[model samples]
Target: MPLYKTITPNSQTTVKIWKITESYQDLMAKVNLKPVALERVLGMKSELHQRGFLSVRHLLQEFGYTDSDLFYDENGKPHLKDGKHISITHSFNFSAVIVSDLIVGIDIEKQRDKIAVIANKFIDYEFDYLNKMEGDYVKKLTVIWCVKESLYKLFATPGLSFKQHCLVIPFTLLDAETVAWIDYEDKKHRYNIHFFEFEGFTCAYALV
Candidate 1:
């Protein structure tokens, strides 16, 4: 059980992160999945994705839930049977879950220079403050990506465009937290964003 870290952003919200260091077979043996989930995992072509899927079940156990207690909406957002808000993400060697009484979202992404190549796809106004020449440019981009990804998960709207609608307020790596907005359909909404890096990966969550 490589439960790497846990965070309580608020009294009602909890974040659990897992550092995936287990073999697919090892992780599979530790979690009991529903029939549909079992079939889904067996059908995955990538062993890494299978392990990531299993690790999330482990995180749900930490939250006192089981595979049967989770389900997905029409839009593919995860939900808890008990009506608590839930969001999940996995990347490379890391996976995370955020459960809260309030709506919330979480994402973990491996920081890679390649992300800069596609920055224009998901980035818009933030470019005004991002300096490609800066030494932490990749790190900053990763954070913005993670933040926007979290927002997307929470919003769970079909037409929400990250480039055109989501905006991450400027912040330095040291700040570790910032604000983000979803400007869609002529209405603006705000969220509190918290993020941090570990083992070459970044984890971020949004709360409203």
Candidate 2:
């Protein structure tokens, strides 16, 4: 069975995360699903995460949805039935879903050793609070990536660069509280980005 958590941003917005411990095949079996139904779902993987999204969508269907109920626009943004807002992401054995009356996004990440090698690529001001010497520093890297990724999903733009456009305020994984912003045209948009690390993975979600 996958571990699941839900975050309620307000009265109308709810974000949910699904974490997996078994292989894709095992997860599919849990829901009595067919893997062949996952054609577009395979695109989410940049490395090993490719098939992860399929599992997430399949799990969603198990709850009360069909694959066709989810659609993507010409700009590659996802839309729910009749155009309700939706954002989705999966990394390794974890996946997340965000549905709101307004714009929303979510991301999940596995703590990996290579995160330190490419910190500058996606994190800006967040580095101020990041010290590689800290305990479980790799977990912190996952948190930062999740924050930036959520911002990217919310921005929903082809050219919105994470490092340049999204900024996460200084925070710690132990603190479990962090802030983030997207300053476009001097109109700063802020979000209360939340982080949680459990069972070797980190998940983040926000509404701005």
Candidate 3:
């Protein structure tokens, strides 16, 4: 499949998503990968994961970049050669990348009832606005989880606890946007959060 969606959140930021319907061999033949990336993809045991990786490279190609333009730091966070901030995520059948002049992070998660089981592990302040009795409880929980995960990716700090260090302001599904803060160490940071759901998956992105 080609590009699934594209969003220009700001003048200097672009988010692109790809729906992975191509076979591993097909995707491999289409995208140009660096030697390290080639070896990494071949080492993946699951074809689904390999396909997702390749789809991300395809998304990079859409932005006129190849695998050589990207690299990972010691913390496993990705970076671009040209110094723009980039965040990548893939879940099941979808892969996405967000590139921005400002610091940014993105996450995509499959909405499942099981998330409610582990909600307490990463949720705290946001529970005040969440009512489990509502029918959209699971969906709301998924959004909160993605929001925290997005903030985590942006911070990329060691020993940061999602439940303790991150706080997502109250938000409703209809609003589609909110604010979040990271109170880590002796400093505090803020972010603008945006989210949406499609095909049983929820995507949340934070711009700082």
The number of the candidate with the highest lDDT is 1
Error of 2 at 12 (Å): 1.9
lDDT of 3 at 25: 93
lDDT of 2 at 146: 89
Model 3 misplacement above 4 A: none
Distance from true position, residue 201, model 1, in Å? 0.5
Tens digit per residue, CA lDDT, model 2, 1-208:
4547777768877777776566656654544333544554344445346447656665566446666677677777778785667888877666778777877778888788998889888877777877878886788888888888888887777877788888888876668868888877667889888778877888888776
Order by TM-score, highest first: 1, 3, 2
How far in Å is the alpha carbon of 56 misplaced in model 1? Answer: 0.4
* Clash pairs (backbone) in predicted model 3: none
Q: Write the per-residue lDDT of candidate 3 for residues 1-208, one digit (tens) a residue.
A: 9999999999999999999999999999998888999999999999999999999999999998899999999778999999999999999999999999999999999999999999999999888999999989999999888888888888888899999999999988999999999999889999999999999999999998
In terms of TM-score, which candidate is stronger, 2 or 3? 3
lDDT of 2: 0.73
Model 1 residue 141 CA deviation (Å) reads 0.4
Error of 1 at 64 (Å): 0.6
